[model samples]
Target: MEIPTELSSYIRVLKLASTPSWEEFSQVAKIAGAGILLVGMIGFLIFAIMSFIPGA
Candidate 1:
């Protein structure tokens, strides 16, 4: 697309979007953190199991 068109589209999006409330941001942050921790725990569990195997 042309630069002018792209710039206009970006401006339109910015005009339509609003900043998230503090509570909304906090809730999303908590959910994202929980997901990261859960993935880390699963990876660690897999590593632990592999280390215990005979030839893994």
Candidate 2:
């Protein structure tokens, strides 16, 4: 049995997408975590400020 060229190319892409090195994954995860934390902190600050302003 033989795979066609197009099918082989698709399989190669799938394989690459499914596997990533640990360092690459960790770096992405760290960036995502920092972004989430920053957003959360900003939201908390806004809420705190609104509470103090009394009319907002």
Candidate 3:
């Protein structure tokens, strides 16, 4: 079986859309980044509390 030229072009575009892009990142970057930051902060806080233990 063979794919048509137009079908191939549509597949190519579909493939590109399936990948992340800077414009899409720009829209959600802050939310994603903040979640990461929140996680890091919680991790560091846990680490700091652990370090405060006498023998940890």
Top candidate on TM-score is 1
Off by over 4 Å in 1: none
Backbone clashes in model 1, listed as residue pairs:
none
Per-residue lDDT of 48 in model 1: 97
TM-score for each of the candidates: 0.94, 0.69, 0.54
Each candidate's number of clashing pairs is 0, 0, 0
Ranking by lDDT: 1, 2, 3
Candidate 2 TM-score, true structure as reference:
0.69
Whole-model alpha-carbon lDDT for candidate 3 = 0.89
User: After superposing candidate 3, which stretches have Cα over 4 Å from the reference?
Assistant: 1-24
State residue 16's C-alpha deviation in candidate 3, in Å: 9.9
Give lDDT: candidate 3, residue 55. 88
Q: Give each prediction's root-mean-square deviation over alpha carbons.
A: 0.7, 5.3, 5.6
Deviation of model 1 at 47, angstroms: 0.5
lDDT digits (tens) for residues 1-56 of candidate 1: 69999999999999999999999999999999999999999999999999999898
lDDT tens per residue, model 2, 1-56:
45698899998999888666999999999999999999999999999999999789
Model 2 scores a C-alpha lDDT of 0.92
RMSD of 2: 5.3
Q: Pull out the clashing pairs in model 3.
A: none
